[model samples]
Target: MALVNTKEMFKKAYEGGYAIGAFNVNNMEIIQGITEAAGELKAPVILQVSKGARAYANPTYLVKLVEAAVAQNPDIPITLHLDHGPSYEMCKACIDDGFTSVMFDGSSKPFEENVAEAAKVVEYAHKYNVTVEAELGTLGGVEDEVSVEADKAMYTDPEQVQDFVNQTGVDSLAIAIGTSHGAYKFKPGQDPKLRLDILEEVSKRLPGFPIVLHGASSVPQEFVNIINQYGGNMPNAIGIPESELRKAAKMAVCKINVDSDIRLAMTASIRKYFAEHPDHFDPRQYLAPARQAVKDMVAHKITEVMGCDGKA
Candidate 1:
């Protein structure tokens, strides 16, 4: 099958009470790892690229890498998405570059400006049969170029969701329900709880509308432990609990963004490989295990957390 837009995938996920994993990708190994896992599980997936990824890998290389993954896994559906697209031009560029979906994250802009920008992108994207995702509230923490301080982060107001969706004509909406970016999502003493009430209210407002959750990676403790045990010093890193993420997936959320988990998994595996094989200098010697670690992490998320396994 050809690369698909997220419209059909999100529709099925929403109806089936499962969410598709939107894993961030920057290179060939990450793309292979994520798509291979999804293909084996017969699960649909969203391979997302951030601005940072585009800058690091170049847009052409990233797009071709995703194309290669699609060729390798023709049985499974894959959507190439732009995560947290900072501007209308960026979103349009992705749409023109063959991305099936693009997110215009105008969360930092004023309400009216955000609506205008998102509406503009949606109009252009729809002309090419591409899907657009828009965000209503800001998420705290840093991912790529997106960074919001904890105090500045705000929850999506349920009252505004209907208007936002109606005005922007977005195919999906990403609402802030207390999940933040990066691994250190919460302070050590703070309670890491998602405001499911907000999600419920948003669902009621926009019935059957596909919803998205950003910064939803449940930083698996095993990967963290491995990184630390292998001589890394990441202290007090925390993430949203898998149980809570499962609850969201069962609700209105149709897509969940997870990037940090893959990073941790790859980092941990490479660190461990280096510790054990000190004499091995070839890049593949370490990167091979790192790739497998990504595959395992993605598989676990598909089967255990997102509950989208076999949904393709």
Candidate 2:
């Protein structure tokens, strides 16, 4: 159909032991790639726009591009979401502009202020039947305008989950359970393990409430190698393992955020294309393959990691 909020989608995903893939969109190719993959797999998808994305590609352009994608794939469910919304005004602006869902990312603020601002946005968004996702704990690493230090990152306190939910009335809760933002989530030698114990505790406190995982991209080694081989120097770009993400999908987690993987795939494809076809000067000639690479990555995530394929 058209763009929809994550309320029903998350409910079904939670009951069915799957998580909806929330892919970030920065341009027309990225939007096309994500929706094409989701439509082909018959999976529900969320196309999220970050503040940086809105600045790079104007909000109207992004909205219309998503609308065009929906028109192209009428059978698949797609939602336009505001990722890491920093303030109530930002969330409100997106809602008024027809975003189906919005996240009030107040994780870096004081807990009381976070809750208060989230509550205010929730109050306004609910009136329009839009879904609101609120972050409880700060996730480390940087993505666009959102940034946090590793030392400052904290796993969401399971004890405060119920109170936060009760106070904010948010549809979903994004928790930092050891997953950092950006492609370099962990070092080369370090382990990448999600805090499932914290997830379990949160689930126990608010059973069936939709849980969200940010910075969940499993950076494919293939893309990393391709980029490096094609004259890029991205050293030790590690991400959460696919097995760990699959486990989270089987738990209370109903939404998984992925951005860096798509970027890596697209960049690697373009770099390889340019290296091989040095004569090609047209943007579409190379961007087409890059878009296809993104589609492939997202399809893999939906089928293998999130377990959301054919769940539309």
Candidate 3:
């Protein structure tokens, strides 16, 4: 009926051995596609807004789009989340603007600084009943304003998780265990692997804690092929295997953030549509199919990858 925080969702996910899909939202079609699938399947979903998205779509428009989704899907629990908020000001703004959850990503900063900044955000967000998510290690690849070289990426140290959580008092912890951002996550002929061992250690150290995974999209080759087939140039864009993500869900991962897959699905669909109908100049004509493709992809993720189809 209204925007809900991730607290109860993550709690149920941890106990049920499933993960909730946190889909990125920028415009009306993306939000419509995500919430349509979620409402139809009765899955609780998180609609996250990145800093870049906020700038591109205008924060006010994004909020109105999310509120529209709330009105349209009264039976499903949906969350308006700030994804990868770069500073306390951004987090505070989102929390005050009606975001149910916010993520303060200080992974690139010094550990002590990260803890301090995240604690500051947590202290303020709690007063409004908003949940905070903080990151531990850096992830590689480009996504919006977040990027790190592969050489600079670090696996989350399980040893530091407890102290960081205790100091920051965060509701969720995002640890970089090997998943990278964007489409070109892996190179050709290389098997994508996740450091599940690190994840296991972190989960053991903080039992019953909710773990968040960023850049967890399982880039469907079918979408890549469709894009490539229609003149797109995304090559060797591999993602974490769904099997691996499912395993992590069974472990301790409660929230899995998926962005690139949504991009690929819509891009591939629009590309194929444009190629097929070169005469169509109507935006609605092409966007309808693109929106449907997004719906299909998200529905698949809800039922297959996220395992949260009926948990709403």
Please list the C-alpha lDDT of all candidates, in the order they appear.
Answer: 0.93, 0.94, 0.94
Instruction: Write candidate 2's Cα lDDT for 1-312 as tens digits.
Output: 888999999999999999999999999999999999999999999999999999999999999999999999999889999999999999999999999999999998888999999999999999999999999888999899988888989989999999999999999999988888898888788888989999999999999999999999888888889999989998876799889989999999999999999999999999999999999999999999999998999999999999999988
Q: Report each candidate's C-alpha RMSD, comma-separated, in the order given.
A: 0.9, 0.7, 0.8
Q: In model 1, which regions exceed 4 Å deviation?
A: none
1 versus 2: better lDDT goes to = 2
Give the range of the ten consecutive residues with the poorest summed lDDT in model 1.
183-192
Q: How close is candidate 3 to the true structure, as a TM-score?
A: 0.98
Off by over 4 Å in 2: none
Q: All candidates' TM-scores? A: 0.98, 0.99, 0.98
Candidates 2 and 3, the one with greater lDDT: 3
Candidate 1 per-residue lDDT over residues 166-281, each given as its tens digit: 99899999999999999988756777898999999999999999999999887777887888998988876678988999999999999999999999999999999999999999
Residue 114, candidate 1: how far off, in angstroms? 0.2
- As for model 2, its CA RMSD to the true structure in angstroms is 0.7
